[model samples]
Target: MEQPHFKSWPDVAPTLIAVAAGRAPADTVIRGGQWVNVHTREILPDHDIAIAQGRVAFVGPDASHCIGEGTEIIEADGRFMIPGLCDGHMHIESGMLTPAEFARAVIPHGTTSMFTDPHEIANVLGLDGVRMMHDEALMQPVNIFTQMPSCAPSAPGLETTGYEITPDDVAEAMTWPGIIGLGEMMNFPGVIHADPKMLAEIAATQRAGKTVGGHYASPDLGPDFAAYVAGGPADDHEGTCEADAIARVRQGMRSMMRLGSAWYDVETQITAVTEKGLDPRNFILCTDDSHSGTLVNDGHMNRVLRHAISCGCDPLIALQMATINTATHFGLEREIGSITPGRRADIILTSNLTDLPIEHVIARGKTVAMDGKVMVDCPHLDWPDHARRTVNLGPARRAEDFVITAPEGANRVTANVIGVVENQAPTKALTADLDVIDGAVAGDADKDICQIALVERHLGTGKTVNGFVSGFGYTGDMAIASSVAHDSHHMIVVGTSRDDMAKAANRLGEVGGGITVFKDGQEIAMVELPIAGLMSDSPVSEVAAKAQDMVDAMAACGCHLNNAYMQHSLLALVVIPELRISDLGLVDVTKFELTDVIKGSA
Candidate 1:
């Protein structure tokens, strides 16, 4: 089938006239609506949008000329017509669905574009996984652009990835039709120090004239920050404070404030524009890692927009942050950000400007969603068998695997614990005194402390690093297991009882790869993430429903950390601050070094 393209308003004027005159040949024409022009931040009333052949042709006061028989005329009832939202930064695997399914989940939320990085999957399944995600994204009805993962191991020496992405990979991927730029370069220390590999990758992305993503996740806004700015990253989304946001924009970087499933960074950072009086154009909205629950139950980019507005930002500025600003950041301003000529006819009709109630959504000039229901088919990809079967436990993990042996004849000891922050991406480094039993240290659930272990699943190494975590508040005989551990994508299991931990890990292995909760030696909830142990082939709503059960299971165990699954996945990520676990060992992320959980600090 030959796809249609639009050039100018004049070319679509006749079709618009036909639609208004009840003689249009277009697929759909929305009439008598107020257009919320995100480009100029204006709401122009009495506008009509003419969509035909899956691309918008005319948007004007009247579309009575291009109308012919069989044209669908939609009366907007004087509502607000706005551009469909765009996510400036995200990860598809974090949603635990393939790109096609992810698109299907967010279409009803009025998200017409997404800039995703498949680096998490790349770390688990390599470049082949990136290709798989990219191909499926192109098949979606809405825009799903990819950023070639810049950091595979994320922190090179901190941990090992299943696959490594080189400078050559970035250069080669630049020619792919759907690749927008380089993914978030998580190696901030490497970039500041001018590491050869990181510099080479940045050079390749620059040579291709694509934007380079940044991640300077530190509180130090000193010389190191300057060094990172000189390293050529165009934008950063790790800012969590007003100072962080102000510094990034001052250093010629776009300040990307994100509102993910667990990351509530928008409110804290949007003050850079709302109070500090910075240029709003340099700010962007992104959902760095939103799970399917947030997408199906809450919203996607629309959620971010609402959060930005609630943080005292102007409604128009919030809309721009989710629209034209994001499009310009990725160099897609001419393609999908605005309602101007030559762009994809992706737009939304809403009832309220501040609340932004999405009533109708049009993608590429075709009405794809109406009243929160998808009206089209979102295609799926045939995932290979290798992606489904990834959990490799070299041997059975015994209770001894989780026992932290004390020094010599030491009876009890003080240990550094990784404290999970609720509904936030950052963790707190905490210390606690524990009682030793039978020459091994055990978790004190009364103090809200539990055992956390990271089992290396990449090469059947069978290496397990044992540690303790607080703030989960888990009591009794319950354990949680997940293969979505971040960065290296290893399996992380936390429990007060060693037997339950082993059972949970074993069940995931039995199901190929998934999350399982066990209490009293019985399974309570499970979600099969058969694709690279990070995503599922099932519909997002189904996965989301199961995810709710997993949440309930955690709560039933007497744990009360908000969105603790997010905290669970990040336990293995060595990039974020305070303390973390990895295949290598427990990492003191602030110092970027391996430290023992019990004593022997530094």
Candidate 2:
């Protein structure tokens, strides 16, 4: 089904004027509702809204005059009528589903608008991948604006991508339909150092009057942070603390506090508005990455808004953060993010403000969902077979491919381990002492340490970089592998047994791309993501069910971390802090270079 094209204000002005003046009938009349006016931050009761030509024509104490025989009347029964929720920043591919499936999952949660960055696809398939995502996003019933991916490799010299996006690519994408802005500029060092490529991408977005997303992942609030902000990213979601949020807003940048499936950043940063008295207008709520399970079971923007309220933010203020604040940041305030006249008729009905329950959702004057069930069709693009065949691990990996050799005569050594921080993106730089068995390093399950390997899948390079990671708490002879590794989209296999590790890695290659868990040399659970090895072609419910099973399989193996699969997928994300693994070797993300896994050992 083709989505209704957005009507310009001028095109709908005549009908809107006629409806407001009672000279014409409205297409839909919602009566007996409490309007949540985000502009004035007020909840005025007994309000009525008249919509015409997919836009709000009139909203006031009564719209009875605008109602006619042909008008569809919705009796709200005094429920809170709030503008549809908007995601300030997100990734559709993170849900492990295609754009259509992702929208189907979130629309029931009242998320009518999203500003998405398809950089995940850009890494694996380059500009063609971005265009595919963009075309599909426009076909969805809800507003899904595309931001041309700015960072494919994320950090130029630190990592390698399947395809590289250039300045010309960014410039060309800015002119594409539905292209809102540039994706997150993750290379903070590049921006601070005024790298030509980073600046050129930022300049192109600015020249086209588009917003530039930011990802300054450092905790240092010193000169480097200042220089990065001065380089031109208008918003950031990488802030994890109240101070980080405060600094961003103080420097004229929107501090986007995110609460994805694994990321719990809103609680720590919402205090900036609740306690520190930062203007709520400069603060936005987003889900930088939410898996399919979270979208299907836990809810989307409604989940974030409720969490913010529980963090001591006023209910209406929290709503504003997810709605008007986000829309205004993107310069789309007048077109969306409000229940006022002339804006798109995207609204939600809820009985309570604190524990917000989405009873009904209307997008573009059409009721798309009601009571947790999506009513409208989210159109899908014909994803070709080439997009599905992304994993190309040159040769069959063997148990020997995952081995970590120790120094010639060393019996024990200290190894740099990637420590997974629970509910946060940044990993802790940690070290552990391990014994050498047969000139090979052994993992200590008692200490929550496991072996990690990065298998090169882009160039058919069959290279595996081995390292150690903590915090999975796995104690069995099991392995987990995923091709959804962030930024570079390589394969990350973590396990206690090299045999199981190799089994899991090869299984992913056999399936073209997906996440798989192997226990005792047998597959326990798996989700086949044929689309760029990062997303599935299945329906959202099917993908969510498989993802939930993957989580259960991990827990069954004594691996217990909130969304451990998400942590597993990010092990190769070389841009994040502390430590990571890549095709080259183990990366010291703090230093942005490859370093030895075993310290002080040749």
Whose lDDT is greatest here?
2
Model 2 residue 179 CA deviation (Å) reads 0.8
lDDT of 2 at 505: 94
Model 2 lDDT tens row, 1-602 = 22457677898899999999999999999999999999999999999999999999999998999999999999999999999999999999999989999999999999999999999999999999999999999899999999999998987877789999999999999988799999999988899999999999999999999999999999999999999999999999999999999999999999999999999999999988898887899999999999999999999999999999999999989999999999999999989999999999999999999989999999999999999999999888999988988899999999999889998899998999999999899898899999899989999999999999999998898888899999999988999999999989999999999999999999999999999999999999999999999998689999999999999999998978899888888888888999998888888898899998999542
lDDT of each: 0.87, 0.93
**Global lDDT for candidate 1?**
0.87
Candidate 1 lDDT tens digits, 316-395: 88999999999999888877787765567798888987887878988888788999999988878889999887888788
Q: What is candidate 2's CA lDDT for residue 463? A: 88
- Top-TM-score candidate index: 2
